[model samples]
Structures are given as structure tokens and as C-alpha cells.
Target: EMGHVLGIGTLWDTFGLLKDFPGPNPTFVGPGAMKEFGTLIGAGQPTPVPVANVGGAGSAGGHWRERVFGNELMSPTIGGPGNPLSRLTVASLGDLGYQVDLDAAEPYALPDPFVIAMAGGGETAPPRGVMLPTVPSSVPADRP
Candidate 1:
């Protein structure tokens, strides 16, 4: 009569999530009982007791090794070729007032002499009051 002779006793009350189930039925056994159960189940090598949080400080240094060696070393300049000049020149010539097609393949046409004459005849020098626009303090309206 193994059932009658089995000296099983429910000890002090323990709080758990599952409380509705019946007698001698424990949710979990202690570590020693687990080892005994492992022997009874014929699991070889005691199932290799897990290394509890081993290699703590040593594991922290593993990431340092990975950061040093595992990643790519990037250049200071990411992509494309570098520019030769320190100051970039942005030449923005406003619309060439008029364009001439000197390379027209057909019979050559002479450009209008009047247009060329007008182009060269404007005042070569800036006006006497050229700086007047910039001198706000010298303006006639501001005079005492």
C-alpha cells in the first residue's frame, strides 16, 4: 500500500496564482525534489544545471570587443569626390540680354549694325550720383 505508506503531508499555506486545486497536489517541487524527479525520469547528466547568471563582468567586456572589431570604420567624408577649391564660385550671369547664333549652318547672315551700335554707345562710366543711392545719411530729405 504505497499510497497509505507514502508519508506525504501538506505543510504551511503558500500563496500562488492557482489556489482552487485539490490535496497533495503541489504546483511545483523544491530543487532537491526536482533532482530526485530527474533521477527517476532517467535523464542523464542531471540535465546540466544551468549556470545562474555566470560571467557577469566578463560578459560586459564582450560588447567592448564587438564595438572595437565588428563594426566598419567610416571615412570623414562619406560619399563622392572632394572639391579642390576652399570657396566655391557660383557664377550667376543674368540673362545675356541678347544671344547671337554665330554657328548657323546656312548662308551667313550679318548682325544688325544698329543693334551693335546701340550696345556700345551707352555711358562707359557710372553716373555722378552713383553713390547717392547708398548714402542714406547724406540724403536731401535728411538734411538740417
Candidate 2:
């Protein structure tokens, strides 16, 4: 939701935000994203590191690399104990056309040491923060 308001993820698979770069690939994430975020850490650099391509409906090939950021807030996974609000994330926000306060970015460490494992079958919790109550079968909203 916040990302929508801030213009992060796109409603379609088109990487219009990253149209400036040249490549046959249609989607980009991580280092490509970092580069777009005004960082010198992407392709053509001495050590070009790219982010993970989650490849889901809305988050795939869009969010920051999971293995690189691990428990960092922007990664697909939201582990317990919370994640860091990294400068890279803020920079991405800026790339997304948001006015970011770079000074307010949180300190982040690479290869986060505390990556919380997800549940079995590689299933993760729903992304939504609020849970809606389920209505009983055959029950109508107008009924008491």
C-alpha cells in the first residue's frame, strides 16, 4: 500500500522505472535497482552484485535481493525482530519518485547474520498487516 502511494512496485510487469538501462531482460532487481537508485554498485562496476528476483505476482523481480538483504525490511521475507531500514532502500524510494531523507536512513550490514527461517514448504505469511474476520457460511451481512 505504502509502496503504491510512493510509486515503488508497478501494477504491471513493465519495468518502466528501469527503462533507462539497456538489456534484453524485461525485469530487474537488486543491483540493477541499486544502480537505478543512484548507486555505483550495479553492472559494469568492479564487483557488480544484483538483488534477488523473487518472481511472484506483484513482488517478483522487483524487491531487493533476499539473500543479500536477508532480514532487511525491504526483502520479500519479513523476519522477526524486524529488519533494517537501509540506505539502499531509501535510495530506491528516491528512484521511485519519492522525496527521501537520506540522513534518516538506518544503518545496514551486508549478509545479515540474523536471517529468520520461514515455515515449512517454503510458505510465508501473508503480506497484509491486518487480518479480516471470516463470516460464517450462509450468513449474510444484513443479518444480526
Instruction: Supply the TM-score for candidate 1.
Output: 0.18
lDDT of candidate 2 at residue 115, scale 0 to 100: 34
Number of residue pairs clashing in candidate 1, backbone atoms closer than 3 angstroms, sequence gap of 3 or more or interchain: 0
Tally clashing residue pairs in candidate 2.
Answer: 5
Model 2 C-alpha lDDT per residue in residues 1-144, reported as the tens digit of each score: 365455554521243444312332333343434453344334444232233344465545445556555665666666587677777667667655567786687776666234324323222433667777887678787987
Q: Which ten-residue region of model 2 has the weakest summed lDDT?
A: 19-28
- Taking the tens digit of each residue's C-alpha lDDT, what string does model 1 give over 29-52? 323323422443356422211111
Query: Which candidate comes out best when scored by lDDT?
Result: 2
Residue 21's lDDT in candidate 2 = 27
Per-candidate alpha-carbon RMSD to the true structure:
42.5, 11.7
Cα shift from native, residue 30, model 2 (Å)? 10
Q: List candidate 1 segments past 4 Å from native.
A: 1-8, 12-20, 23-27, 44-144
